[model samples]
Target: MFHYNATNLPLQGAPGSLGRPAKGAAKKPPPRRRRVTLYGLTFSLPLLAWQLLFFLAPLAFLVALSFWTVRNFQMRPDFDLVNWATVYSNPVFWQTYLRTLVLAVGAAALTSLLAFPCAYAIAFKLSEGARRWATFLMVIPFFTSYLVRVYSWQIFLSDHGIINALLGRVGLGPVPMLNNTFGTMVGYLTLAFPLVVLLQLFSLVFVDRRLIEAAHNMGARRLRTILEVVVPSARVGLVIAALFCFILTFGDFVSPLYLGGGNPPTLSIMITDTTKAGQQWPRAAVIALTMIATLLAAAFGAVGYAYKGRAR
Candidate 1:
């Protein structure tokens, strides 16, 4: 056997040669991980293109238009503040906007209240099959044209129509449904009701049934069980549903147009009239911009609360 003096193993050998295989070349280490450029780029490019072309570019144009002057035959450019002044000064516009805010918030609250029970029914009482059918019915309204549905409401809610006629036979006075503020509210409520119920129902379904049972076993009443066990679990859903209802009701045109008096206008009506009749696209754009901002703020606020609640 050949005896080797081993102190430092590489003492008699070239640097890094001891215990290493004799080689003509050094082995390369495994390649470092490189991000998949194609996948990330492909995933993001289309959405980026869409936002740039359709959303941001159009928004830029609207902002620019809102400041410029309109000539007799063409639009002229200069950053003037008259459009902003006119919008703020008009009392009808302000009143209509205020009324719309009140109705939107009220309708959302009412829908949520009505929906809570229906949600309970589906979550706690109804069989799975019945719940499925009920949920389908709630969603079916969306399958039809929403405008057509509102128009159908106009027909049904009119003073001479079936709803009023049946009520009249029961000795109730005629409902003044067509072209009134009350009619607008009803129309919007009818449309919003199903959405509210569906959202709450879906949320309630996702809650843990075991917790509800625990509440009941603790001698909580039915309402108390829901309050203590169910609502707490589904608070996020309620917040989101309220936001959706508020945005829809605030921005809706068809319900107000078919129901609101032509002269005394809702914000939606004013937006349309400005664009079509008055030919003031700049002013209309400002209203549209403001409405969009309001919607974004509400949605984000709800989302923030949901996240904060979840964090806790």
Candidate 2:
């Protein structure tokens, strides 16, 4: 073998050498990265435009409306704190706001309680075909118009309606149902239960069945397995379900308007009443902004909880 100094060895492609590329070398083309980025931007444009037009633009206008003053039942362009002051000063508004919070929290809690078991059964216990059927049944109620469902509930809860009629036949006087907190909550649950159950079912279906089986084999009881293993695993879904219920119920005017009376008015109803009575757009906007702020805070909290649970 001919011995050669490493420093004196001619490099590849040196003078009089064959210009072959070094083996196993790779080069990335810059345009490939730009193409990928361009593809992502192209796909995202529709969604971005939709949000800007329908959500952000409307929200911006609403915020602007909230700051403007309303004078003589006509909206004035002058910015003032008067609308906010009126909202804060009114005791009735405060009472209504608090009541709305109570109703939303209460309904969400109850719906969660009712939703989890149904979702668990559908997700884990049922066969695939059975799960599909059960899911369909859960959504069937929603196929009916929302307003029609609310009106149906109104009829069902009325003094002479189906529930009261059945109760009266059992020798009990017609319990107060329509235009009360109880009735309002029932209506909220009726509308929200389907959504809650669906969300929770979607969550539960993705949970590893093997983990649940392992927990069971370790002598965990049914309730313990669910509480410790299943619930923790599905916490994100549970949070989403509860958040949806709370947000929907919090902003619902129709249920409280038709089923609940003035004694326990919700913020949505209060906003409507204020708008109808005075055409006070700015004040209404303040109330709207308050509700928006509250829901946003709730959304942030739910997202934070979900992400924290996921992180763990």
Question: How high is the lDDT of residue 116 in model 2?
Answer: 91
Best by TM-score: 2
lDDT for residue 17 in candidate 1, whole number 0-100: 42
Q: How does model 2 score by TM-score?
A: 0.83
Residues 221-280 of candidate 1 have per-residue lDDT tens digits of 988887777888998888778777888898888777887655467788788888887557
> Candidate 1: how many backbone clashes?
0
Q: Output the worst ten-in-a-row residue range by lDDT, candidate 2.
A: 26-35
- Could you give the C-alpha RMSD of every candidate to the true structure, in order shown? 10.8, 9.9
**Over 4 Å off, model 2:** 1-30, 35-47
The C-alpha TM-scores of every prediction are 0.83, 0.83
lDDT of 1: 0.77
lDDT per model, in order? Answer: 0.77, 0.83
lDDT of 2 by residue, 93-167 (tens): 898888899889999999999889899999988999999999899888766677778888867889899888999
